[model samples]
Target: MSNIKKIVDIGDKELEVWKSGKGRTIIILPGMMSSLAEWELLYEELSKEARVIIYYRAGYGKSDKGKIPRNCTENAKDLYALMKKLRITSPIIIGHSYGGLILQEFVMKYPNEASEIILVDSTSYGAHKLDEVEIEEEDGSSTEAWVEKCKIYSSLSKEVLQVEMAEWITEMKKNLSSSQHLEVEEFMSNPVMFESLSEELEHDLLTCGETNQHKSFPNTSTIVIGRDPKASITEMVESEGLHRSEAEEIELIWQTLILNQTKLNYKTTYIMAEGSGHSVHLEKPEVIKKAVDSILNSTEVED
Candidate 1:
């Protein structure tokens, strides 16, 4: 992988943008709390075929904390500005998880600036309606209520914050080597990381609402890669005190929502990444590369 990196001044803040390889640009947007480093494997593979543009979203990695609202529209605006400043137009966009929502907004806002889009285990508008699930909380409220109550994390000390986020860190470590673990640890130590996560979580509903306002996607080739809901059924059942049947039902609903997301565009394809949960790109980078290659090859043929 090349080590070329630069800072782009995006009005409110400077974003750390990394670019490598050559040919058509493939701009990658990371999920909430996910940094550009998480895209290392896929970036290396895709960069071999085309120019890969990955950046640290504001408040992640080497980027400055942003002042804009942490909603999908604002995030898309930042990306549009960055691409304009970099003189990149009509590039392929790949969004993972929350990044998927941002990409939806981007295509909606810019309409004609994207050649194609790939969504990796992305959040769906139907899934955004958390009220459909009846997972009760300690306060007799639903899981959505608990999520709203727990959004304030900016004031926690580093030690406490680390403990709170230990589960995910442990999961990430399972896939990383010692050096990678150390790098992840250093990134997690940044207080801004937690703050940014909190901001995103707090405004998640608003982001979905904004995204819903757009009725159609731009006329572009699109791929929606969804995770196997079965892979996460056990965890969901245990954590939410759900019965086996209930968990299975919820899983079905989740999968359905993911499938329905493809309806936003006429030219759309859906693929299920079996055995991979939400982080399909991390769990199955090769699958992502195949999808990307297919898109790039098709683009080549069209040109």
Candidate 2:
């Protein structure tokens, strides 16, 4: 049975989590607004070699939201505090999407906390490069109304974001005209919040510039996967329409501009899933599992 324990006494609410396995310590952090349970199937495969630690962020999962910071920096701090409390030394860190950004920040703040880091089709460019997508309201007012709509249509959009479907595209288009635009301006304005989160991401890229340390992590057996440019998909709601070319460019930004900025300590294996889109893990779980397995077993890996 999967063991899930709420971590208490820590400043920020976190959880002590794992399935079953023993060897290296692997810590798994899911995407933003996601729960640790998201790893249900992935854990089955990864736990075969090492103990997997999947914790719920403060605002996510069973963890309470009070007193917990939602941005990336605070999120990383929470993970660090949890590790210290649990007495985990040099555990391997694995992050997906926003989770990846948190780990990336943590690594910069505390470079030696992990024996290795694995990024699974994650967003690394930070808020600056993140696609500013918004939904317009009927009254021509721009608000997080889109995210609110998302919360309402969570069940359906969840599948759409994870797996590309024509219906989702159609629904998104239906709202475009009546919807108002909300840019990242609001998200970027919170310095104590947003800027702090972005700093770590910028540092990671900066570190890469001084030295192509990308190979170093890989030498330590760290692995990273980039989304396929060709298979990328974007949904434009209402009046918004994502042309095939634009979607492909988005993938290129991640692979060519964002991810490529890092010079790995070891040879990084870049695999592109032709059939998959942004959410590669959901679109192709088997492929993700295979990649994870290979990295875990490879002799080049340290932890």
Candidate 3:
């Protein structure tokens, strides 16, 4: 497969997009604080069967940082516009983490434009509610504390930033292979990554609020894959200061929320990645590939 990279002007700003393979289009949407390179493994695998479009969101990679107040609505609109400009029709949409929320808004607004939707370990509507768990920090308010931390992160020297990012990539390598981790590390080395992430976090609450309003999503073929909540129960309890029992209860609540996601559509399938964490696509690419293939094959049968 050959990679075709291009910059498309989206009125306000330009987005860097990469396309490869041929056939049905499958657009991969990256999560918060991530670039298209984060999907390198899955993109390589999926592109073999279908045309894949991966783009850096505004403020990441070579993409221009557009205006602020960039909540889910704005994100969804930008993606829809890009698809229209590219003349992509009824494409399969795959969203990871926060990208899933944007996908939700997209399907709701342009129901006819999407053939299927796959949400990989996506965030729940209740994600904005953090008061249930006590997050460890010097300040009581986690949001305010996080904002202050971002300021510190933004001010770090390039060498210190690289070191910090390397450490993070090393931790992520536990879930991803060495090469995959290296690719992600290289993409994240861009200073703009942190800045974009901070800007996204600034509108987290607003984004979730907008998502909450769209409880009834379009009735389309949808797949919801959630990482096993058991994988993080202990970490949540120990690090987040939640009681052991509380952590277990929270896990159950999370699973319930994930299951509830299927209610958004008429034909929806839910899967749990047995040993995977939130980054199921990276940790268990086979699971994701199988899901995508299943959707594609099913779509073919219907056609």
Candidate 4:
């Protein structure tokens, strides 16, 4: 299949988008820290039967930098703009990590624009608030790691950081080839990316609160794909060198948020990706492919 890549100017920002195949459309809003290149696995399989659209969101990778206060709501607006430019309507939208929060904002704002939502290990609504859960840790958890990464990205040379992060990523994903790490390393090595990343981090609680304002989103068919937390907890314990108890507590918080999503969406099915961690799309892509195909088949049958 011929993969078409182009720059789409959506008003203020120019977005780098890649598309392939035809029939139905699938829009993937990857993690803010993610690369469009990293979605090659999904594109390779899904594009055979569907029009899979993956892009570097404004201010990430090759995409033009976006406006300041790069909160989730703003990012959601960017998604809407991109869709409007491409004349896409009622397409299946998928979000992972922070992208999920952006998806929530989009659904809340546009309501009827998406036919379905597939949340893959997405950051849950209101999970950042202290009152959202009973257990709280004051010393810092994963945030500390992100802060350290920011420092490292700024301090290290691009060549050095690229090698180290490539090896680290390969170990973490296990299935990814080192060749695939180029785009990811390039994005991470840029100190400017951390600026946008940190701004998003700063406004995360605000975005969560705003998204939580919409308790009843459109009754669009929704599917939740959560990675088995055991693997993630083990990663936190080993990779981050955290105590088992700390990691368990962190995982517990994450799972609680993920499970709470079921109560918010109508006709939602939750699936846990066994032997997979946070990056379910990378580790067990077949699960996602099946999920997408199921939703697409059902949608077409109704159409």
Tell me the tens digit of each residue's lDDT in model 1 across 1-303: 584889999888888899999989999998876756677778878899899999978777778878765666678888998998999987989999889988887888888889899998886655555446555343434434534434545566667767876776776777665656765765666677666666666566534544466456777789999887777687666655677776777778777777787787789999888787777878888878888889988877988
lDDT of each: 0.76, 0.54, 0.77, 0.78
Task: Spell out the clash pairs found in candidate 3.
Answer: none
Candidate 2 lDDT score relative to the true structure: 0.54
Clashing pairs in 4: none
**Number of clashes found in candidate 3:** 0
Model 2: runs farther than 4 Å from truth? 5-8, 12-18, 66-68, 130-221, 234-241, 261-269, 299-303
Better by lDDT, candidate 4 or 3: 4
lDDT of 4 by residue, 7-26 (tens): 99999989889899998899
Q: What lDDT is obtained when candidate 1 is compared to the true structure?
A: 0.76
Model 3: CA > 4 A from native: 135-144, 155-160, 172-186, 210-215, 234-243
Instruction: Answer with 2 or 3, whichever has the higher TM-score.
Output: 3
Worst 10 residues of 4 by lDDT: 130-139
18-130, model 2: which lDDT tens digit per residue? Answer: 44677677788877434344455677677776787787665443354445324566677888888888788977787887677677667766767887677777656433343
Per-residue C-alpha lDDT of model 3 across residues 164-258, encoded as one tens digit per residue? 77866666556555656655665556666666666566666434644447545778889999888877686666656766776776677667768
TM-score of predicted structure 1: 0.87
Give the range where candidate 2 is weakest over 10 consecutive residues by summed lDDT.
180-189
The global Cα lDDT (0 to 1) of model 3 is: 0.77
